[model samples]
Target: MRRLLLVTCSALGLLALLPVNGALAVELPVRKAGLWEMKVLSGGSVPEMTMQQCTDETTDKDMSTAMSPVAKEICSKQDIQKTATGYVTDSVCGVAGMTIKSKAEINGDFNSAYTVKTSSHTEGGMGGAPRDSSSTIEAKWIGACKSDQKPGDIMMPGGMKMNINDMQKLKALIPKQPAK
Candidate 1:
């Protein structure tokens, strides 16, 4: 369950680049319709993680729909801006009792390859420890989906795979926060 959570969040965060303004709908340019290979380098302690996603236009839309409500509920500020290079996103949200402030810059072409560089600060979480962190997401088109893979399929580390569309079921498993 934890692995799936990590995989899900990582994939969504990477794809959506942490979203901005659910009301406005952070509609990122639909990536080329095909398999995408993504390499993520996050923080210092965790080793680099690589994953593959079979994606399509509809799948990207579905991801935005799925994550928007949660973003709306937890995020106080989410904004995206067009830059000369590409896109820049800034967001602040509360998650699992932590308040996170993040800024990300995206560069490169979506149809071929792209890079997102992000820096963030987190405080007042379950551990009550504050920290600053950054991550780099580098992704490129691979090809069509594999024979065994389908849209929304994410091949995680160690060859484990999960369908993002199926992850809605796990919402019930998350413990809800008590009233403030």
Candidate 2:
């Protein structure tokens, strides 16, 4: 379950890299400021998980790190191409003994709805059990947030509610780099 979550989160981060302009700038495509729901389907191993997220331009910018600063140390290659309708990206990333090569496509409108599909191949990990998987995520705007839900808040799977910023702690869990 945790592995799935990590992959899902990383995929979303990569999708967020879709450029708002042709220069492949740092800005993510703009979406309305409100509550949005994302339903993720991962090869049927994990049941669909629907989570609501509060979004605004600033929040989106903060969450959308196609590649985190530290991630650069691990990801050796990245290529992104803008298309008439959406964007396509391919990247190679490594973490410890695992390395992954992935490609993704995003289509539809960011303001109202969009779909993201990603496929990846993982080598040198998971007991050598041929690691390959695909996932689809559909996100739609859902108007105002619940009264109790604040911006940057997300209701994750397992009925767990957490502020998106809290996810930063996961960065700490990454193994430290050996002496440079």
Candidate 3:
């Protein structure tokens, strides 16, 4: 469930980067340097959880695309429009024979707080059944990072800390595979 929310948040992060003019270019509002708390609620099927992250300017920007390994690989095209309240996006993407059509509406000031509501439908999913889901995420600034926490450090729901930027280090932690 947590992983699902994280992935949803990743999509929202991409949405946040949309230009105010509705351009596809990534232009994210600068969130203040501090600790942030995000609460995610995805359908009744998943439990709600609040996760905190510490960020600085660089970290905040990097986080926007952390989960987006390849935009073109996933989304064929994404259309974003600025709404009176926040922004809206209509996206289409496909992977592994699964096609996803999604729409998202975001509200609130990204500098301090914001909420994203999203609904998506997937066809040809793992179970070969059409899947429809909706999720809401609320995030707000929560003062400074803790003494032990630094920029780019994310504290997952299970109390595990990770620096996503240090992929090499994480890879090092995994034992190498033996030759066939």
Candidate 4:
């Protein structure tokens, strides 16, 4: 009877050591606000300018000779404008014939939503030479942050969506061991 009781107690202790599989609990980290900024700079060549002028020295000659250079000068400015447009267009998207500088800021509540403010400046070239513009966008997250019980993963939500693939990719990006 004593041996039987000892065996039964040992078995119960071993069973207690075994992990319980159902409904494992995990602790999730609190999300916080983050900020990022991006800037773009671009430039192009200047166009030549032509102006008509009267010349007293050449007054004896036909007035047409003096007037010819002035006409060419005026037309050259137009060609410069066209060339600058072509260069700027090739360099940046949706932004042409001007140099653009922009700034953006975001204030985020990791749990719920975020607000963004952006502003831009453009300059150089003819016809409405320099201008500045600003815009804003607001966004929200769909769900609360959560953790996974699996060996190598954490689950989280971003901007009104739960991206399982992103979570997996993020898991891969994290190093298993710290660098020396």
Give the top-scoring candidate (TM-score). 1
Query: Considering TM-score, where higher is better, how would the candidates rank from best to worst?
Result: 1, 2, 3, 4
Which stretches of candidate 4 lie above 4 Å from their native place? Answer: 1-95, 124-128, 143-180
- Model 2 per-residue lDDT tens digits across residues 68-137: 5545555555667778878787766665556677787888788888888888887875556558878787
Instruction: Provide TM-scores for the models.
Output: 0.85, 0.79, 0.75, 0.25
Model 3 C-alpha lDDT per residue in residues 1-180, reported as the tens digit of each score? 558645554543444333333336534466788898878778865777677878888876565454343343356557777788777877776655566777888788866898878787878745699978777879999899999998877787778787646633433433332222
Model 3, residue 92: C-alpha shift (Å): 1.9
Q: Write the per-residue lDDT of candidate 4 for residues 12-39, one digit (tens) a residue.
A: 2212211222211211112222211111
Give the clashing residue pairs of candidate 2, or none: none
What candidate 2 gets wrong by more than 4 Å, as runs, is 1-27, 65-67, 176-180
Model 2 clash count equals 0
lDDT of 3 at 48: 79
TM-score of 2: 0.79
Candidate 1, 60: how far from true, in Å?
0.8
Order of the predicted models by lDDT, top scorer first: 1, 2, 3, 4
